[model samples]
Target: MAFEYAPAPESRSIVDIKPSYGLFIDGEFVDGHGSAFKSINPATEETLAEIAEADAADVDKAVKAARRAFRTWSRMPGKERSKYLYRIARIIQERSRELAVLESIDNGKPIKESRDVDVPIVAAHFFYYAGWADKLEYAGLGANPQPLGVAGQVIPWNFPLLMLAWKVAPALACGNTVVLKPAETTPLTALLFAEICQQADLPAGVVNIVTGAGDTGQAVVSHPDVDKVAFTGSTGVGKAIARAIAGSDKKATLELGGKAANIVFDDAAIDQAVEGIVGGIFFNQGHVCCAGSRLLVQESVADEVMAKLKRRMGTLRVGDPLDKNTDIGAINSAEQLARIRALAEIGEDEGAERWAPPCELPSAGFWFPPTVFTGVSQAHRIARDEVFGPVLSVLTFRTPSEAIEKANNTPYGLSAGVWTEKGSRILHMANELRAGVVWANTFNKFDPASPFGGYKESGYGREGGRQGLSAYLKAGA
Candidate 1:
């Protein structure tokens, strides 16, 4: 008999989402010049709130506001800025539960993840960067690294608030004012963050939240007075941003897409490697840029790993995002769900053996079951392309050299995993892997103190730790 779990849904009442939200500019909420758009709850396909869209004019106003605030913010003592950052961190902790619930409702990630992982890390990032706000001289950039002027930032929807924390915390810590555009589908948490900025008594215009789609993002990126640009999204857009600022003086840091490999050796702990593989590809419904979507296993142990992996996947609970027992939740949007479905079909068309555990999906809401494709080859589209969903492609390698060659064949170099008990092998693989971050016995782990970025199509520039601060600072200052 299968084990049954009682539903323990988290309460959403704590998050007092407004009926409509406006652009957050210069410490105020005001109407936008562009048309309004509705923010939907992916889990239930309900309209959560109407959001104001920032047009070119609105983005310019925000950029001008940030530019004006840069004069005072950049000139203020670093220690004073530290106080405000600390206050924001404290407030985030105080209201973490509300933020987590709101994140689940809007973003369709599990409540447990939003509660335990996302919100806590968001606060930790602020705390970590707060310490550096007063100590830039020791960052090894130079004697007195100076702030880049106003920064224009855009974040993706997959990990909405967390991505915002990654961009906003260090930029503020380094004394630059910002105009940030949150993804249109998941804008509530960022708007709430705007309120937190006000609650912390941060200076007017220091951090502005502009809500919109692609055109607004382009406006923010191409704005003349914006001195810096930071974006986390698709590699195609990252290229566009690079092109937009190619001849300009604007500094850019882009964290984009990936097709990471998770390699399991015959000597590895089978149970541990299976769990790592599941988490690597299924976490956040595989929306992560550095998700380990490709599985390369030694032929000697591939059968054991696949059998255990299929068993583990059979037990995954996919349903309401608010349910504490849910292991997986709804996909973020209809468009993303379509993309995942299309890719899964392509995997079948390419002669890959597809398998999904017997699971009943909700009648409503966007969702895809945890899926795996076997007998996939390096030449297959499923193996080469990023499905960006809860789909894993399995391939076998007979030797370590073959594994290394297969992993490095991808254009993306964001992250990869090596599973084995041998320390020397781990070290050797870490060195040989072309990924920006290589994990041993673990995957999808992140810390505010560790630097994270990628290479090639995955984009460039680090986002955490001391190196991250440099992205917002003028060189040789």
Candidate 2:
């Protein structure tokens, strides 16, 4: 007999989400010229709050504010900036519970993930960049690298607050001011972060949050005053931003889409690989840009691995983002759910075998069962396209070279995983893989100190570590 678990829901009362939120520009909350939209909780389809949408004019206002603040912010001593970054990190830690709860409510991610993974890493990023703020002279860029005045940054919805940290922390540490736009679906946490900036007494215009859809983001990217542009989203949008800034002098770094391959060798421990596979594709409901959606198992161990993976998938609890025990949460929005469903149907129509564990989902929310498609071929759209949900496609490879060939066949080279106990095999596979970050025995792991980005369509430039600081600074200044 199996033991049934009771729902362990995190309380939402801790986060005081206002009835409506306005744009955060020049250290104050103000109304936007664009129309407002309601932020809905994906888990219940409940309207959470009214969010102000920023238009082109509002984005220009933000850029102007950042440009104005850049004069003083750039001149401020790095030691002073370090103090502010450190304070922000501490405050993120202090209010972590509130932020975690709010993140789950607004973003439809599991509470445990928001609490343990997202919020903690968000704070770590701030802390890591804070240390570098005063010591950038040794960053190896130059003896005196200078700030690239106002940055225009746009982050995606998948990892809302965390992505903001990836863009904002390093920019601020390098003495650049920024106007950031969080994704339309998940703008709440970024708005709350603006409050944290105020609490840290970060100077006016040092960081601005504009809430809106694509038009506002375009405005920020095309603004004459923004000296730098940083974006994390779909590959299509990344390309658009690249084109928009092509003839200009703006520095840009884009972290885009991925269809990572997780290769499992026959010599690998099947049980351990099963867990890693689950975490790789199912963590955050497979919304991760580097999710190991493609599983390349050695033919000898394919059956055993699939059996184990299926059994593990059966144990995943799906429902209620606020539930501590839930492994799979709601899709971030209705449109995203439609995309997932459409791709899944295409997989079926293309003759791939689809299987989902017996799991009951919430009736009202946007949800998808954890799905696995076996008999998937390289030509199948499901194998090539990013499902961006809790979906996995399984394929088989006989030899190490074949595994490498299959893995590198995709347009994306963001990340990949190799599972094996042999140290030499791991090193050899790592060298051959085209991915930017290759894990020997793990997947979906990230650290603030390590640099991350991708090759090919996965987008260019790094986002973390010392290398990331260069994107926000002028060389040899």
Encode model 1's per-residue lDDT on 92-191: one tens digit a residue: 9999999999999999999999999999999999999999998999888888899999999999999999999999999999999999999999999999
Report model 2's TM-score to 2 decimal places: 0.99
- The window of 10 residues in a row where model 2 has the poorest summed lDDT is 1-10
Per-residue error for 313 in candidate 2, Å, reads 0.3
Error in Å for residue 463 of model 1: 0.6
Work out the TM-score per prediction: 0.99, 0.99
Worst 10-residue stretch by lDDT in candidate 1?
Answer: 468-477
Cα lDDT listed for each candidate = 0.95, 0.95
lDDT of 2 at 407: 100
Model 2: per-residue Cα lDDT over 257-365, one tens digit each: 9999999999998898999999999999999999999999999999999999998999999999998999999999999999999999999999999999998887998
